[model samples]
Target: MPLRTWQTTLCSFVIAGALVGAAGSATVTPALAQGPSAPADFTAIARERMPAVIAITARQRVRERETAPALPEDLPFREFFRRYFEERMDPREALGAGFVISPGGHVVTNDHVMGNAEEVQVVFGTSTRGPVRLVGRDPATDLAVLKVDPPPRMMVTAWGDSDAAEPGSWAIAIGSPFGLGGTVRVGVISAQSRDIRSGPYDDYLQTDALINRGNSGGPLFNARGEVIGVDTAIFSPIGGNVGIGFAVPSRVTRSVTDQLIRTGWVERGHIGVSLQELTPANAQALGRPNEMGVLVAAVEPGGPAARAGLRVGDIVTAFSGNPVESGRHLSRAVAAAKPGTEARITVFGDGRTKELA
Candidate 1:
């Protein structure tokens, strides 16, 4: 499904139920009995993290084409209308959000927000800082790092262990929705490890938080006010918040942003091979009882796999002693590896098992 930018308000209603006793007396049940207790007040958490959540305004140069004005069919000016149109270059501004990740002025946000920006500015608590330098951007994860000379004292948010994020856990989102700065919204983690097909490393944390267009590149916080995810996209049909939004997990964000800050670019290990899921038929053909691991569909010439003698029809059983459960597992494992590091690869092929390094 096409993902839309999220923005708007959420309406909620309460339904009360009554129980009747044998004496015809009605008893009212507590609303909390239906589910978990009311969530604790997020006011403290929001107040603490709101300062770090900054609004971003990116300006880019764009081409604007002028359309010819309509003319009457019988009017002699119809042919002259076509000659008056022209294209002009103009500046366009895009608004989004970001959060400070370090005291030295390192801010983290979505790449799409600042990737194409010619001029970037950050709005923090009524103060605007202009022309923030783009430290680096990783399009694969839709994350970016920006550097600015922050005030003497800046509030920085820490990263939480996103792997600990579970469904039904409380989630808070702070951003500038529709150019409204310092907006706070709360929800629960609806899901984790969601592959929304936004990118190859798409381990997104799904939430019902009120994330919108301007919320992109903002921070999604846990109950402890730690950053757990970076708001990126939303699944909306009406170009507004429908309670479904996706954010890049902080685990991935931390790794990518750290690299981007330190090196201006991300270096992902590449073992050139096309992989497919191991099918039952292929497992049977290979004399295996069950479909496990990933099948090597093709090996690139002169790449790591080719140099390691990996061949077509070979099933990758493990990577550096880690079992490969599926193609995504193998892909993530391989990409996480440092380039130039020798990896122990186990494969099942030719009706036998072999190890390659």
Candidate 2:
């Protein structure tokens, strides 16, 4: 059967190269008791953290030949043409930056950097250095881990609590943009929980830092000199910084990076339901005064929502006690929920509020 127009109107979060600021207003930090806010000492922070920062280059392997097609014995074939293309151009090389996280040679970078890389190299500190090895990567969060056995005394960047980082707080970026290693840009946290449509868990810390091409997978630091975010993408049409950049929050990266280091990938709970935004017409049909909740267009058979008794045309007002304001909000909540655990969902159905497990 053809799906209804309302069902087709549903929107799932997709990767958009946008950095959404805080929902309403940006949150500012109070001035230090000593005096008015002072400029963050980027020099001091860079000095303490730059040694751990390393430049990463990913080399992709290009297969020069494929399986030869079988032909009839009578067909005239040209075997010389296949050998002629052997001296073709080499595969492209991708460049990005990473930082050492552990003493045992654990490093962190964006997964996209190592996505197609058959050979990975890690350059510690400045370019006047040796290479390292590629470990594991998590594409969902755009994080990768690399390992390099240095000459001992490897420096590391301390990770800050991303949950405590408020909007309007100072954010400093250090990365290799345009292949220039050890570059720095300064800005403020423009927003939080920004869904940049980059990945399923798209919660990003939006910043107004001057980020540009080649800065992907770099560190976003707070005034305390702790790493809070990883510079990944920017929102610009000209490919230059227009004072808007997005960083993967440490809250998300820490967990994903840890898992990637241990295992080879990160696992996310999936409910397999088609999520739709609550429109005025749909709300009216459900007897809602206004469009407020997310609608469940279709629940996967035997999936989490289906097992929880969620149904079509039901408006989910809350997920696991968190009030859901839109489809995007609800989707994030559900995606973050732990699998195999029952969650309470408040829904509006048949002109009445109902609770479903």
Candidate 3:
């Protein structure tokens, strides 16, 4: 199934992108005493946290190529027959949501929501609205940060642990769905560690939080009003919220957002190699049916992996002693690593576990 970006208002649907926004922390924040099982002051918490949920309107230029005008052959007067339309790109404004992450007014939202943004504006409510500056964006993770001069009484939201968020736990989402600002919806965590294959790091928290179009880059908070995920996409056949939505987990968002806040863009360590998944169908032929690994399909001659003694036909089982689940898992791990660092790798060859390289 193809997941749309949840970006709208430009002859496109409101549902697109698989996840949204920045997560603040990797550590677990405790839920309230009377958490999801027993509702307590839901309205109050929503009110307190509501200010952090901001609406975003990004105006972007849609570029189009213009070809030279063609003259008609049937016309007696070729000059009169010739016609041309001025080559112009249309400017469009897309609406999404974000939450404040810093006291200095750092906001987080989905990158897809701000496609080629020429200008951006953030609104806290009906009264507070102003132009904002783009801090950084990571399209690979569908996350971005914005710097806004928050109005008086605006507050920031804290990041909760998506890793600690259990299935069936209560979830709250706040965004500008259909450009309706400060809309709140409630549901539960449907599942965790779901891979919708949106990116190299595809671990998404599945929730039934009634996320819809224009909810892109919104915050999905737990019962304690802590942000655990960014509302980005919905799994709907009919474009409306069907209760199945996906969010980018805090564990991944936290790291990416921090880097973005420090720098205008993100940089990742590269290990040049092409990999094919090791699966049951093909693993049997390699004498390793049950074990998980990826086939080293192609190794660049002078690349990091090759220089570290990796060869084509090798089955990469682990990296730095951590088991690699798939090609994507290894790729994400390598990207997360610091550049110019030594790599510890384990592979399979000759029908046995190969020594670390």
Candidate 4:
């Protein structure tokens, strides 16, 4: 089967699973307790958010080598003939979803969706199509921004506070699923702060909303019809939605998109150090409580951490007065900090605690 057809079939087969998986063995908060009386109608929210949602098609040229066909060994004088072969240049199209974030034609979507494409087209509603220019992309967060010359008076969606989104709150996903544009799937935020091991910064919002192959870069809206997340990837062994979809939270999306728009790149603060999680045994050996903080294993020769006098075997307990719960917590804090800014770091070593600037 063709790749497109396989993807369509997978999405069709898993629609029911995506809808029903929310009822699985996961705890969800009651909707009435979330906000004002349960949203009387999701239809209204979908209608309001659909205009900002868009379908994106990216085209790329790929070179593929032809494979030799298998032949019976007894039938052939294969050695007497030379196979004439040449690589074929094939044009491939990838489908995804995005939303208009500004009236000036700034659109936001997953960077993977925009994957090194030679050309991109944005489709609004059903038929309004326009070519888009890649403004910026950040692969670390899997987010990208595109610019289009959209007609005046285009509808835009506002970014919601992803930090305010709690598990059990309603999550509505609008996007092109299997190339079917204007599709909406409703479910609840099953979990938050999900690290699917996708990247160094792995903070993702997990949802049971039906995010399939073509749903990448689509907006995941809260009950208020504000975009709280951008659907990115799904955890499925079968290449379909298994009720384990992950989205780049708006908190990260906003930070990345803002920087990308301004600088065309994300400048992350780096304190060069290799860190290891403080396991119970390591902590006990270090005469500290179990799993207290991250242990510094190595410091770069001339990096910020080394210049700040950070050394191997040092336990980083906190950063800028915030407690470091784990290696990930410390990494995230450092990455989010502005470069060139001085920060207070707390570390424990040599049977004593010291504060470093």
Report the C-alpha lDDT of model 3 over 1-357, residue by residue, as the tens digit.
654232211111111111122335587888867644657647976889998898888888886555546756776765443423334577888999999999988999999998988888788887556667888999888999988887877788999999988898888999999899999999999999787877787778999988877899999998888999998877878767788999999888888999999988877767778999987766777766465889889988887766666677778887766778899888877777766655566677656666343
For candidate 1, write residues 1-357 as lDDT tens digits.
654332222222111111112234578875753545554699999888888989999989987788877777898866666655656688988889999999989999988998578888899989988658889988998888999888867999999999988898889999999899999999999999888877777789999998987999999998888999999999989977899999999998988898998899998878889999999998998766468789999998987778767899989887766677888877877777777666667788776677776
Query: In candidate 1, what residue range of length 10 has the lowest lDDT sum?
Result: 12-21
lDDT of 3 at 74: 75
For TM-score, candidate 2 versus 4, the one ahead is 4
- Candidate 2: tens digits of C-alpha lDDT, residues 274-315: 889888887787777668788989988887667666689888
| Clashing residue pairs in candidate 3 (N, C-alpha, C atoms within 3 angstroms) | 4-16, 4-17, 5-16, 5-17, 6-15, 6-16
Measured with C-alpha atoms, the lDDT of residue 304 in candidate 4 is 74
lDDT of each: 0.83, 0.75, 0.80, 0.83
Better of 1 and 2 by lDDT: 1
Rank order by TM-score, top first?
4, 1, 3, 2
Q: What lDDT score is found at residue 158 in candidate 1?
A: 91
The parts of candidate 1 lying over 4 Å away from their true place are 1-39, 66-86
Question: Can you tell me which runs of candidate 3 are displaced by over 4 Å?
Answer: 1-37, 63-88
Q: How many residue pairs clash in each candidate?
A: 2, 5, 6, 0
Error of 4 at 203 (Å): 0.2
Model 4 ranges off by over 4 Å = 1-34, 69-86
**Higher lDDT: candidate 3 or 4?**
4
